[model samples]
Target: MFKGSFVALVTPMLASGEIDKDSLQNLVEWHIESGSHGLVAVGTTGESATLPMDEHIEVVKLIVDYAQGRIPVIAGNGANATDEAIFLSQEMAKFAIDGFLSVVPYYNKPQQRGMIAHFEAIASATDLPLLLYNVPSRTVADLKTESVAQLAKHANIVGLKDATGDLNRLAETKAVVDNNFALFSGDDGSGCDYLCQGGHGVISVTANIVPQTMSEMCDAALANDFALAKKLDEKLVGLHKELFVEPNPVMPKWALYKMGKIKDPCLRLPMVLPELNSQKLIEQRLSQLGLIHP
Candidate 1:
């Protein structure tokens, strides 16, 4: 049931590095108003790595509350440890979240069989629909198409967010899974192309800045109006590329702050602010889009 521009939301923080509840709630309302289809909280873009378990759970809970059944909320419940992934899934299931975005086990790369086992265990732990996330660039562990097809058999394991940015692989993946199984592009740069190629939706990072454009682009593509979708997507190509000029959420947070959407562009330790050159590049893109003044 989940589809369209599901923003991999960035958790707004105060200058003290604490979660900014007001900013978070405001963002939720803004997305809903902007026509974003769903919210994916505490994912990589949300800086889940820096957030402690308690804070992670808290953010998901808050997003659910703020959404108030108006939009779907998918909790980022992935962990490198199988047990930890299960624990997160179970804990997040207590909230009103629509599903879980569980990443491929990172750091300690697992075999295909191990990955299947890892997701199977998580599926058994909760009835919530689970979306497997394959981001080998960061995880170093690719979730193979065969393994994904295998996991797609589990009722609880309902879909996947493929970040490889390979449209050919998307066709291959679509070939393997049943039509009912959802396939989302985790890569923003190719999101419209992904939809045109038959992806159900996008779990987008760029949507954090231009939720309206992303949502509209997805709508056009889903409606089979590829010309309109391409036109809309062209406006976003700069954001899709530049937001990652530094690591994710750093530039996104800064863009938000510049837009007066948040008070501070605070990030936790080990993930600091973007360099001045990167900031200028991001600002230039934002300005080009008319999202900010030059």
Candidate 2:
């Protein structure tokens, strides 16, 4: 049921590397005002890997409580371990998040059957809707087309956020699954085509920076207006690529800082701020888009 320009929101943090509640509140307001379809709080862009369990749940709770049904909030519940993911989902469910975005198990690189087992276990544990996240680049283990179809059988396993960017899989997955299964494009560059190819929506990193344009593009695509969707997506091409020029949330956070949406783009340990060259490229793109002063 979740669709359209759901931002992989960055967790706003202080220069001291602490969660900034005021800035986070302001960001929720800005996104709602800017017309983001929904919010994916504590996803990859939200630095989920770096956050402690308490902090992660706190962030999700804060957003859910603040949003107050203004928009849907999908809590990031992916973990390397199946039990950890299930426990996290169970804990967060108490807060009443709209759904959970569970990524493929990273580092371990399980086989398709193992992947199926992992998701099925999580599905059995919670009645909440679960969106499978398959980013082979980050997770190593690719959740194959057949594997996704297998997971789709479970009642709670609702949809997928596919970063594979293979449009063929859009048609492939749809061919196998029931009509109710939603397919959200996680690859921003291919999002317009994904929709035109019959995908449901996008779970976008670019939307964190340009929520209105992304939301409008998804609206156009969903309306079957490829002309309008392509035109809107064209403007975002620079953002789609540049935001990932460094590891996520680095450049995205920087872009938000430049837009004055957040105070400091401070990241946690192991993910420092972007370098000078990367910063210059990001700034040039932001200026080109008129998101920042030239």
Best by TM-score: 1
TM-score (C-alpha, index-matched) for candidate 1:
0.99
**What lDDT does the true structure give each of the candidates?**
0.93, 0.91
233 Cα displacement, candidate 1 (Å): 0.3
Which consecutive 10 residues in model 2 have the weakest lDDT in total?
1-10
Model 2, span 146-227: residue lDDT tens: 9988899899999999999888989999999988898999999999999988888999989888899999999999999999
Q: Give the worst 10-residue stretch by lDDT in candidate 1.
A: 84-93
Query: Which is the leading candidate under lDDT?
Result: 1
Q: How high a TM-score does candidate 2 get? A: 0.98
Segments in model 2 whose C-alpha atoms lie over 4 Å from true places: none
